[model samples]
Target: MSTEFHKLLFEISEALVTDELAALKFLSLDHVPRRKLEAIHEPKAFLEVLQEKDMIGAGNLFFLKELLYRIHRIDLLTAHLGSSREEMERELQVLGRAQVSAYRQLLYGIAEDLTSEDVRSVKFLLQKQLPKTKLQENASMLQVFLEMEINGIIKEDNLTMLKDILQRFRADIKKKIDAYEEKKKENYSREEVRYPVSVSVYPEEQGAEGEAAKQHGKIYKMKNNPHGYCLILNNHIFRNPRYNREGTLQDGEAVKRVFKWLQFETVEYMDLEGKKIYETIKEYSKKDHRNMDCFVCFIFSHGEKDKIKGVDDECVNIDDLVSCFTGTNCPSLAGKPKVFIIQACQGSVRHPSVAVESDCSGPLEVDASPLTSIPDKADILIGMATVEDYLSYRSRRTGSVYIQSLCEKMELLCPQREDLAAILTEVNNEVAKRELEGSKQMPKITSTLLKKLIFEVPQ
Candidate 1:
């Protein structure tokens, strides 16, 4: 909004040529969506788009400086941004400062180093993967890389195909790929949450804490940067229109925000079928979770007594779902805490409210589902929205009573190092006092965890 800032951007935009503009756009492909970048032709227009995206503005021009530095525009950097090459280098070196992903930077760097002939050679090699229409003669290396990403030929996690193509003709460039992968692996390992895996109780663990930790006898290790994955399976629309679950999206959003704030790699799978839901769980179970400290799952859908119905109106047995993470099935998570939060009606009946004061009063809907009776597995905790054969309450405007309360309680108590069992007890107490449709909802927590599960608060 500053007039001086707009004048500075306008002057810088005047200095950039077409190719330099293309290069700037390529370098910024990670931060801005591809579809958005495709519409801009002039440098000033691109700068305006970046401004709209909050990528550049007054007192927030680091990304613009990075773009200029990458484009070898030191004159513009010095004159307009009042920054030098050395200053940008030092700032970028700080951990988590760069907005662009390292993976995208690698691809752009490779494209810049390649000649037109080299790009044609690369496109010829990718003939089998992408359609011929996308690999036309006028296609640039950046475009070819975009095609590879869109076609699943390459990704941040998997770059084998790109390396293979580069190694065939450009062995020198292939070496860069090797170095990048090695450095990435080192960084990932260093970033993982590290803690002792042994479950044996230590005196120091028990002696330092107050009544909360003493009550549980021992504490679960959650020393990793991201304790573990918090997978949310939200079924909003069912194949049978009448079974559509309203307000479940709110539940997923609430949990996602809380878990991400708690430093967990929160992922959500929306509107999955029964079979897909099982497969999703199995897929996660197969992943190597050695670097993680704990695993949490949230399932929001319709259900019967001991079964949850997917969007396809097909039911999955609650027992079978939990079985996917037994010690034998997911060895890496054996000693780590595994938590499941269920939001569904257990039965058709409603629990009678015998309260002195009514706390929960609002428009209510039901998620028409489990916990408890899990197999003999240690380090697993299950939180159910309601007791067996009882209906739980959810609001169309807000989320389900149990999940919202649980997220709030975690945000409040986890910072104080309160164990999860104690946190869920607080959720139980909170939800039990509320009256939804004149009926009380009591959340249930069934845990085989032998130790107190406490999350470390970020400083």
Candidate 2:
């Protein structure tokens, strides 16, 4: 082995044998040469102690051995100093399988009141050395090297090796981020402004007008906007597995029930005769190009992550529907906000009964296909019924848990709030608290909003 490699190994082994923390500090700061040690008032205190013990040798091995002995005494003095055992263990776990473990073991063994910041500083030292060690190893050496490699450290023959590795890593990450932005630009190049919104209501399934009336009041209050036009799409087809399929209500009847309760400037009941849901969204997206500031797509159907079933029993990919409004096709709304509110199950079943007392009730389901591709420049906000792998509820009595809370918040909260992000944060907190009460399903929102959205409807 080369003298440099041998010296490095001896220093590491001696440090490991000594107080690991001191060893880590020494190695991390490049051995802190003897001249630098003179700055301290007790410069030769450690060396004099070692000499009294009659242990002295020339070169690396002798000095390393004496240093290790001094470190051992220091370790004895500092033990019994930090927090509880559990907190120490958690910090160690975060450090993972690295050279830092040896130092942590020594530190925790001595201290009873060690602060988290202290532990982090020690870990940071080990993290810095990982890359330098990785680059110097041969293939055989590399295989046996046990130290975890720190990201962005590389071995090189040139003097500027460390600087080169850092620059390379930064450039690589930047390239990936830039590509993402370019794709977003290509997707929304049409118009610079657009407006889109989705409105959905599940009217009384049967003789439940009283419950529907309360929900209608909430929806009515939700619809009173001071800006932006509203396009409401109502789902009227009812198919109960318990009853004969042929006896279910027709489209006209379902539409009439919906119209009896809510009002909008342009309200259209989904024509579930034989057409696909994607086709319907595509048709509507093209209408009235004059009022494009944002885009809203509301879905009220049985859905899984990426798929939602239509009223006519056809399943559609949620991505297929969302693609129609991409920046590439709908330029008017490019870089504007695009919102999707889905009321569906991403999974198959609801949670079984629990003993805890609660008022919120719903199935634990996840939408199988939610938004797969999100635009970076354009603002996209997705509000789902539950977290991934849980059921969302649609009660025979109450409509949807998310919709109810959303409408209530819009009326009671939005009227008073100016910042949409703050409003949504409140909505997240409210839904989380309420849904956990009666059901296991909790509402969630994933957003990459580019600009602030204010829902004031134009008079």
Candidate 3:
């Protein structure tokens, strides 16, 4: 390795050694098996051991890069590891393709091994057939395959094969469920059942009333103008020398304009550290929302999977940010729609392009808030720029693909009295049509609401 690269690695190793808990998590995530971690104090020694033991595999490099980001040493990653977005993704692609092939084989093996005994019961099958414990082992490529399979996004043949195996398991579970219910002389509710056999299927909304229920609440109709506060935590600029998110100001301006047009009082935070971001939200959450009809928050920043970065490079989980305004945490906002528009990359994985084309807080008062919260059960809509573990594009010239399309869609649709979900669906469609260097982008929305959210001009 080059001298400069060696120096960077040494610093990282030293940092890890000093942070025992973080080191343990890192080791566990990457499966770096050693009797103890204390002996690896220097980078050179660490590299040697990893190589000798075959612990530093290609699959684990993805997590290692994320580890660098989590610890705020991305500068070291770029300087020494040649991990520019393109370079790193190229490496990941090679490893990803290989892993996919291996996982296909693994799936075949599992299919062959699935005997009648394996599907004896749902509980037993989940614990036995799927290797559930090992699935929690690391953020590996195999997990991606499992998610794709579960979501029915894999190839039809493969999906059919996987489903064939699962069908046996499901059938056996249903038999068991039937027997137990017969014994009790009653049918059990779906919610009351504890079986992994249930496959979630969302029914299509029928008619305006059904669509309206999914969009926003009946309270929206009682008010002429939307009453709520919109907070824009925009981090266009960064303290990290390696990062510069140009055109992000446009994202902030566009969101501010839209929410303001929606008649919601809006506040924008230009650049904040992670703690300050937490503090701002906490303070905002404490405010009474008795008169407000809804809440909107837009977070624009650099991010990794499940977390966005503050100007100072500290990472904050997106879940933590949204939970600050959950019903239990901010009771004043209960029964109201809380919308979060997040503009950030969710992971390091890059979509393979077949062709061509275009495209908080406050350090002064650290937000000692916990990194996670009990996810609110209802009335929360998280609009992520991209699906988890994928990149969301941004132009040095024009803002992000997702936010720009979102604002444009809202601008056009809001005037027509269309609901938020409809507009977001249009945004997703518009973004799906766009490509950057042959790579596609897709926005995702996770909503739990009982009413339609339509922002109409005040009479």
Off by more than 4 A, model 1: 193-203, 206-416, 419-425, 435-459
- Choose 2 or 3, whichever is better by TM-score: 3
Q: Quick one: best TM-score, which candidate?
A: 1
lDDT of 1 by residue, 1-459 (tens): 899999988999999998888888888886678888889899999999988865677866878998888778999999888899999999778554565668878888899899888888898888888999998998778888888888888998899988988898899999998999999999867645333333343345543453443444356776787889999999888887766767778889899989998899999999999989887887897687878989999999876777777887777888778876766456678768899999887766644543221112222333533444564877889998877667777777676889899989999998878889999999999999976657787778888997779887787
Better of 1 and 3 by lDDT: 1
User: Quick one: ranking by lDDT, best first?
Assistant: 1, 3, 2
TM-score, one value per model: 0.52, 0.42, 0.49
Give the TM-score (vs. native) of candidate 2.
0.42
List all candidate RMSDs to the true structure: 14.0, 24.9, 18.4
lDDT (Cα, 0-100) at 124 in candidate 1: 84
Rate residue 252 of model 2 by lDDT.
Answer: 24
Residue 66 deviation, candidate 2, in Å? 81
lDDT agreement with native, every candidate? 0.80, 0.43, 0.61
- For candidate 1, what's the RMSD? 14.0
Candidate 3 TM-score versus the reference = 0.49
Which candidate should be chosen as best, given lDDT against the real structure?
A: 1
